[model samples]
Target: MKPSSFLSLARFGLKTILFRKTDPILGTIIVTDRCNLKCRHCSVNNITSVLYPYAQIRDEMHKLYDMGVRILFFCGGETFLWRDGDRNLRDLVTEAKDMGFLIVNVVTNGTFPIDLPEADLILLSLDGARERHDLVRGPTFDVIMENVQNATADNICFYMAINRLNKDAVREVCILARETKNVRAVSFNFHTPYPDTRELALSKEEKKACCAVIADMMKEGAPVFNLKSAFPYLIENSFPTPCRQCVVMENGRLSVCGRCIDVPGLCAECGYFFVAEYTLLFRGKPKVVFEMLRTYLKYV
Candidate 1:
């Protein structure tokens, strides 16, 4: 991140904390719900399968920016699958920066080539090592790895959603992120089990064990993009839900926190680490705020 961008974000954070503002600082736009692969734990893919038109997407970006969203994420059923005539995902990233978004990130399943060097981070899903990952996301691990190895920039962050099947492979992914050339770091979220995927949800003890491994990896100098200070809140789901500093826009409709916010009773079981980290940060949790500074500066 650029110094100016970092400073601007710092100002926003300080103001939000001091004033106890609920305005959003981060926003996500779902470019499309069209996906090539159907992962086992996903409930949102292929419902509409619509690649939203470029004009509509551009308008959504403007709306988010106007609403004080400086950190932008272009998400997908598969981002690389989104293309409207001549425009592609890369064009959106560049356009977002031109439109003055301080930090623009893209989230993809890593099933396609990664060439968006303009993005600050490409949150690529890698669930686990070969067999485990293949089991969850189908037999595309080799293809995704090849894409990561040949990506145009060193901005890839391994995004792992830990669940029953892939929980044991967390260490394998952390090691991969540490060793992979184009990868910058690994970020984690425990599987937020939707109605259909309830069986994949981890028990409290399982979540505790996963956090222990992640904390140990951080100590060993692995570049993890998540804050260890928020692990307890994440494990217990004790942190505030529907983070006020974050919002999501899908197909022009907006929602606070995430699209999952619409799922009734799901907030209590939220496993998203960022929600725990951010909500705790704005609520003036000293350790979370301090460790967020340390972790983000080091890896983001």
Candidate 2:
């Protein structure tokens, strides 16, 4: 990260903490809900198969910028599948950078070619090692890995969403993150039960065990991107919900946190690690703040 960008984020964090602001600093725009693969644990994919037009997406980006958002994330059902005539996901990312977003990130399943070098971070979903991952997301693990190996940029981060199906493969993902050529680090999020996917949620004991494994992997020099200090909060779901520091815009609707916040009881069952980290940091947790700084410097 550039010094100016890092300073900007630090300033935002400080202001948010001191003033106890509920406004958002980071904003996620769902480019489209259309996806190619149907993962068993996903509830938001292909609901309507609608792709927002370029003009509409551009307008949304500006709207977010006007609302004090500096960091931008372009998410999707499958970001790569989004297309407005000849334009693709890369165009949106470039436009976000030009729109003064300090860091523009994209979250994809890594099924398509990894060619967006303009993105600050390309979060590739790699649920687990081959067999286990294929169980939930189908038999595309090897293809995604091959795409990662052939990626044009070195900004890829292995994003694993741990659930009952792939909980044991967290260590394998850490090892892959450590060994993969263009990959940066591996980050984990426990499965958030979104109605239909309730069966995939891990038990409290299972979550604790997974966190222990992740912590041990980090101690052993694995490139685990998640803050080990935030593990307990994630397992217990004790952190505050709807972290007002982040927002999501989808299909012209602005929402605090993400779409999950609109779900009936999902907020209390939230398992997203970043949400916990941000909530704890803004609430003036010194350890979480220090760990966030260290992790950002190391990975970003």
Give the per-residue lDDT of model 2 (tens digit) for 26-136: 899999999999998999999999999999999999999999999899999999999999999999999999989999999999999999999988999998889998998
Whole-model Cα lDDT of every candidate shown, in order: 0.93, 0.92
TM-score quality measure for candidate 2: 0.99
* Clash pairs for candidate 1: none
- What is the TM-score of each predicted model, taking all chains together? 0.99, 0.99
Please identify model 1 stretches exceeding 4 Å from their true place: none
Worst 10 residues of 1 by lDDT: 291-300
lDDT of model 2, residue 142 = 91
Each candidate structure's count of clashing pairs = 0, 0
lDDT of model 2, residue 147: 99
- Residue 95: error of model 1 in Å? 0.3
Q: Report the error of model 2 at residue 30, Å.
A: 0.4
What would the C-alpha RMSD of candidate 2 be, to one decimal place? Answer: 0.8
Q: For every candidate structure, what is the RMSD over all alpha carbons to the true structure, in angstroms?
A: 0.7, 0.8
